[model samples]
Target chain A: SQQGEEDPQALSIQEGENATMNCSYKTSINNLQWYRQNSGRGLVHLILIRSNEREKHSGRLRVTLDTSKKSSSLLITASRAADTASYFCATITSYGKLTFGQGTILTVHP
Target chain B: DVKVTQSSRYLVKRTGEKVFLECVQDMDHENMFWYRQDPGLGLRLIYFSYDVKMKEKGDIPEGYSVSREKKERFSLILESASTNQTSMYLCASRAGRRALWGQPQHFGDGTRLSIL
Candidate 1:
């Protein structure tokens, strides 16, 4: 069974707007990480929030983790057309395995 | 920069043929993993190796095997290729020892395999 499920299978937003994607996992995890995949490219790590951390920021990206709810959200501020990609949330198990979500397709139209 | 390289961007094989997909990492990462991606199914891990000559089964390991002869290289093998096994295979490597799963993974571009 998949551990993480991403909400909003697809999302469309205009440039300079904010984009938020949510992910919910079904198990206890040490941490949650977000990754982006461009067309025909491999996944690139974006941001990671630890279990004990509530919020983290990296440049225009903000990540919020709610361990109590077993969910996390990634926020991209002032989105651009280059931000168009498939975003996935991954949950790490105790055994060092990562289970990825179905992913959210975000298209930032310029 | 960390770079995980897959041997092929695309591959085609006939059913019942033996197939091998190779991956190499340049960051000297201690962990390597193999996954297959399909539409709506997401990426399902097939196998992972935490060290040289060590391997473990992942979520869906049926009909698949792995070999990690060296620390920087990991290989996934299909004993007998089948049509249903066709998918986009991705290779990832993380710079962590066993049980240190918080680190981010670097991925290869992936190999689109077709089993005819």
Candidate 2:
């Protein structure tokens, strides 16, 4: 079963604009993480936000978690063509299982 | 920096043939995992190991078995490769002991398996 579901399966934006993706999970999570995958490559870790943390940031990435709602959102500021790829939200179980979402394909037009 | 390496980026196998996919990590991390990704359905876990000689079944493990004979290497075995088993296989490692959560996982480039 999928633990997380990402909204807006595909998004197209121009460079220098902001892109936001939302994710919702079914069960409680120990932590939630965001990852970026270039074409035909492995995913690269972006940021990790614990259940207790409502918001966290790393460079151009911002992650906000709402435990009460079982949802999270990722915000990428000043998008670039380099950021054109699939973004995934993974929910970590207490037992260390990482279940990834369907992913949102973001295309940034330069 | 932690590095996870998959044995192959592409593989082709015939139905009923036994196949093996291997992954290695250089960080000596205690946690390793195997997952398969398909379109419309995200990445689904197949197996995981917390330490050498230890294996645990993930959500989908019916057609797969895992081997963890050494600390740095984890292998996924397809007892009898099937058409449905063709997908992108990913291996990931985390820096946690005893299967604790909260740390980010490092992933290999992935193996795109095609079973005929």
Considering every candidate listed, which one attains the maximal TM-score? 1
Error of 1 at A74 (Å): 0.6
Task: Give the alpha carbon lDDT tens digit for every residue of B1-116 in model 1.
Answer: 99999999999999999999999999999999999999999999999988899898999999999999999999999999999999999999997765566888899999999999
Across B30-73, the per-residue lDDT of candidate 2 in tens digits comes to 89999998989988899999889999999899999999999999
Kindly report the docking quality category of candidate 1: high
Of candidate 1 chain A, the 10-residue stretch with the lowest lDDT total is A90-99
Structural similarity to truth (TM-score) of each candidate: 0.97, 0.96
User: Which residue runs does candidate 2 get wrong by more than 4 Å?
Assistant: B98-100
lDDT of each: 0.94, 0.93
| Candidate whose DockQ is highest | 1
True contacts kept of 2: 0.98
- How much is A52 displaced in model 2, in angstroms? 1.7
